[model samples]
Target: MGFRLPGTRRASFATKVASSKSCEVPKGYLAVYVGEKMKRFVIPISYLNQSSFQELLSQVEEEYGYDHPMGALTIPCREDVFLNVTSSFNRC
Candidate 1:
């Protein structure tokens, strides 16, 4: 899966950086930055409806409010924790 945020595009070192081929999220996917390094992850939009995921969203709201420094949804958690939580979705 590809990872990127809207509006604030990071520079790519790849040779083919087309202006038209920007980071556009697929219809049912959402992009979020996680951890202090702000690593980006693209996940299914359906995850938002899950109780476990909603709890994480709550933490994000409490910490960042609407002012996300990354210009996209940011989840304030360790990368491993976020991965563990999201990986569980595969079982459901």
Candidate 2:
């Protein structure tokens, strides 16, 4: 089975994008913006502890310091690469 975050609820992509308000992250999750289009994804806060994810955070820090123009955590990578990295977490 795929690894699912404890409090995650499966939402259709369109529903997720449409339903998610600009600042409405749930209690156990945080929102991140990714890719050139700045698509938003709500992910478990636990991901912050993953080394690979931390590396991505580091990249963001280097590129944007403490001032993210999007006013949220923004990952500076292609959507496919971000998906590949996070998907690997499911296999562990």
Q: How many clashes (backbone atoms < 3 Å, residues ≥3 apart in a chain or on different chains) does model 2 have? A: 0
> Model 2: per-residue lDDT, tens digit, 1-92?
12244344433442464247667777777778888988778777778888999998888788878776888888878877877676566453
Q: What are the root-mean-square deviations of the candidates from the true structure over C-alphas?
A: 8.2, 3.8
Query: What shift in Å separates residue 5 of candidate 2 from its native position after superposition?
Result: 4.1
Against the reference, the lDDT scores of all candidates come to 0.66, 0.70
- The global Cα lDDT (0 to 1) of model 2 is 0.70
TM-score between candidate 1 and the true structure: 0.71
Best by TM-score: 2
Query: By summed lDDT, which 10 consecutive residues of candidate 1 come out lowest?
Result: 11-20
Give residue 46's lDDT in candidate 2 (0 to 100). Answer: 79
lDDT tens readout by residue for model 1, 1-92: 22223333332321122222457766777677788988766666888897989998888788778788878788879887886777566552
